[model samples]
Target chain A: MADNEFLGNVGGRTLSKPPTPGDIFFDKSFRFLTRAFTWATIFLLAFIVYKIGGKALPAFPDLGIKFLFTSVWNSSENVYGILPQIWGTIYSSFLALILGGFFGITIAIFITQDFLPYKVEFALKNIIELLAAIPSVVYGLWGIYVLVPLIRPLANFLHEYLGWIPFFSTRLSGLGLLPAVLVLSIMILPTVAAISQDAFKAIPHKTKEAAFGMGTTRWEAILRVMLPTASGGIFGALVLGFGRALGETMALAMLVGSMSTLTLSFFAPADTIAALLANTFPEANVGLETGALMYAACVLLLITLIVNIAGAVIVTKATPGGDRR
Target chain B: MSQTGLQLPQLERQPMEPRALKSIILSAITIACAITACIPLFSVLILLIYRGGKRLTLELFYTLPPGAFDAHGVGGFGNAILGTAFMVGIAGLISIPFGILAAVYLAELDPHSKISETARFCAKTMTGLPSIIAGVFAYAVVVLVMGHYSSWAGGIALSLLMIPTVMLTAEEAIKMVPNPMREAAYGMGCTPAQSLVKVILPVAMPGIITGVVLAVARAAGETAPLLFTALFSESWLSPNNPTASLAVLIYNWSSSPYENLIELAWAASLILVVLVFVLNIISRSMGGKTKL
Candidate 1:
């Protein structure tokens, strides 16, 4: 066909020739295939919610909304409650967030502030990320053999000397909230640090320069100006870290002692919803007990969904260039 | 002369200002925090090596796990190793194609369409879905429906976790392809599909592979999603039977009363860690090459 020959003209452009039937068919199928894949991906989230929610529905008639508030969880008695697990999940995650968040932000500042050589910074970043690559089960194993024993003396000392305080009231047991919180903090450090590092990096260079130009010290700029500007992203990081900690199962199941209790003492044994699900699900009977466990899973899913959506929103909004990825 | 003489006595270097002291102290604190954050990593690694390394043996790679009361050197988690590989491979098969295709739609076919935007949001949200929930979902959708536990269900659970990660990363990689290349392909009278396959996908292959490797690494390490889905087995890999995996073996054995089982758990932990680390390093290197 001639270059200017056209079977159809659209948008004032001459066509060499119309697409062949085979080409047209292939193009339509290709587009349809990709669109189907995209929809399938989107449909997956909805399907998960539906399946889990439907499975959990039977529990509402038996346990009622009181399931969220009642603490006792005796399988033989047919009365199940996730109150303690819920409390433990929130409490340990909150404490982990505080410890992880502080150190994470500090590490972020340390790496992003040009304090270290570029090569050193790059190596440090990679090392921090390596923490994430280690399996949770391995952390649990190490916690049992190494961390719990290592922290026992300190925990006992705090209990002995400062026993009046609620946080340090209980003596250090073999597996308790303290080790779980510590390990959880370590597990979440990478997420918090990596996100906050991006947040700090997203700040306009002039902002830092302007602070320095105003005769401010490095600390002054970082503490007063940079932190305020990146607070949204940092908050988002903490939220996401909290979500991760809440969902963490294997490590907490091994380390938290799986004792269903509500206590302020960090040394007391506690259970989380995720840990409870993991420890109990395999052996649970296919009735009220299983339904209750599914109910708990539903609750956990709801919490994580809310937290992650909020964090994602905050992060996307706070990012300066608007979705660099 | 008088003014110079009066100022000369006061010109000695003053003591360090409090502001300078505070800055130095804060800097020290941040450096300290960074060091503190690293302590756990070193501790975990050292303990894994010191404890897990002792249990490492050539026999550990090929034997089945010892019975609970069996002697120390009787068995290994060879079944779990194979199971992990088989299930993770299944997950890769399901998610890699779906993720890359969805990415192509988002980054190439209609970058700013409403459906693309919604799909992107859904992928991001799915990234935060708890692995346990994914297991439950699989249990409901696959196990309850099929009336049995299988590696297929486990892979489905893992694919649920893997899809978002692969999709997001693949999308980023595809978008990173230079715009001029696309224009050049079209300028050469290439159709959209042809340009995508020939020009865009070739350039984006490394980044996509990096995502795949990372997703696979993550899937291999996951225990929660496989707990109820794959369950656990003592036997070798079977499509219908429950399967063992390194992560679950570590979880199950770490708590056993037997000293030998504990030792096996440590060894499995070491191997799992090394496997995940290698995958991560591979992905990191590939990612560096692609600069995505």
Candidate 2:
């Protein structure tokens, strides 16, 4: 009460308050709560690992090691192979990365340039951010109705011109790996663009001007200094986009055609691990079906874990003040 | 000049300098890419609206799903709207306090400990956790244990997905609070807990709320995690019943064999997008106001 009274009165002179039993309990409990919250994350991570592993163990005895390489997915036979889905996930993710990385960087580089007016910059940034906010399912719905139909003619055109190329040789079905890749790219563009924009923006103005002062043109300055300086952050952005593409579910499920086999042509239908889980989960009878499904999910878990860890490390390292941290 | 040299120089003259061409090309690429990048954005919005707009009705929002044979996009998806709200709301209730407390622990109590670093890394990695895996975890823990799929399981999965995002952003918000505020609170003979609640937390409230809102947006948009955990129901989803969600409705209807249901799917997609976009805008503007 004295301390409370002292705090109420300004210029009360430096006064130390005696800790009361109630105050001590309150402080200890507060500490306990925060500590518990902190540990909850670590515990959650372990619990996820344990839950997936526990469920997946039932399938391990049935499928053995062949589960990774086998592509045939007959649930009745107690055979579940995720190889095709694995390949599809990796292939589409990288393809999306290339698309997202290219267009996303282009957008980032575009906005970072000094010549662009503020109005244009603001609008461009807004679009990219809005693109990020659009739900994956929304993107999926759009891809199903609009993008796939548009891709059909383009697929025919490519087949007519580049039929000999394995990547473009598959029959011209509108819904396939290519549509999924395209959608994935569009989905991740905002991620790459935003990160790179922030990284480029974080650059010191003098560093950029110094390049210009040395008789370099705008292109030369950007290429020589700005890009090189922000390369770490840019790579982090790319990886971030790749990780997103890998884990993307609803959109790719709708667009990727759900073909179960691995094929070289980009025009073929395919299933990512996520798509497979989403599409088959409802119909997956019981016992081995569910267990193997969880197993596939476990694989996705490991992959995302590594990717996200790497992204986190990269991002932390690339932060402007990471050296101090 | 000698006649031969003068003639050759005049004949070989180029229209623009190489440096000029390089700058022009670079500028063109940047502007061109920015403009072209917009194609997908415009296309997605226009197509979704064109496809989804005609199907929306007040009945779609107010009533429960008609039986499968009953026609139109109206009435059926009302359950989904409420279910998503229920699950995400419950998730927000569970996660926000825990996330903020963890963030405060990192930012104020122990900024540089190894445990804190490890916790930070775990939270970062959790951001990239595949939503499907979260579903499986919830299915195993809640759905299986409860003997059926329920909204509670769905909320738990969403909470798991949301905590990392909420925690990381909350950490950033807490750290952003000026040190002087904390010192002043302490100087007033306040305990550490009092300082945290009375001074530091108030200063950080805007940013923390923004983070929580973003987490809610993410949980609301998610489909994969809810698939196994919540499952789907065509009827009204009371707290004890199986849940319906807009994302799952969009997924199911878009792929259905029936034409009308597909139309309904588009309408549902539109509603879902609008909801997510509104939440996104709110969280963004909230952060923007804080100048963070």
Candidate 1 residue lDDT tens string, A1-325:
4533553445446545666778777778888888999999779888888888899998899899999999999999999999999999999999999999888888999899999999999988988999988988889999999999999999999999999999999998899999999999999999999999999999999999999988888899999999999999999899999989989988999999998899999999999999999999998999999899999999999999898988888889887765655
**For every candidate, what is the interface RMSD in angstroms?**
1.1, 1.5
User: Best-fitting candidate, measured by lDDT?
Assistant: 1
**Candidate 1 clashing pairs?**
B64-B76
Summarize candidate 2's per-residue lDDT along B140-201 as a digit string, tens digits.
Answer: 89988989889999999999989988998888888888878888988887788878888888
What C-alpha lDDT, on a 0 to 100 scale, does residue B209 get in candidate 2? Answer: 89
Error of 2 at A158 (Å): 1.1
Candidate 1 docking: what grade? medium
Write out the backbone clash pairs for model 2.
B65-B76
lDDT per residue, candidate 1, B1-292, as tens digits? 3575554453332337788788988888888888888888898888889888998998888888889888766799899999999999999999999999999999889878888988998898899898889998888889988999999999999999899999999998999999999999888877788788889999999999999999999999999999999999998899787989999898988889999999999889989989999999999889988974
- In order of listing, the candidates' clash counts read 1, 1
State the fnat of candidate 2 relative to the true structure.
0.75
Model 2, residue A283: distance off in Å is 2.1
Model 2 C-alpha RMSD to native = 3.9
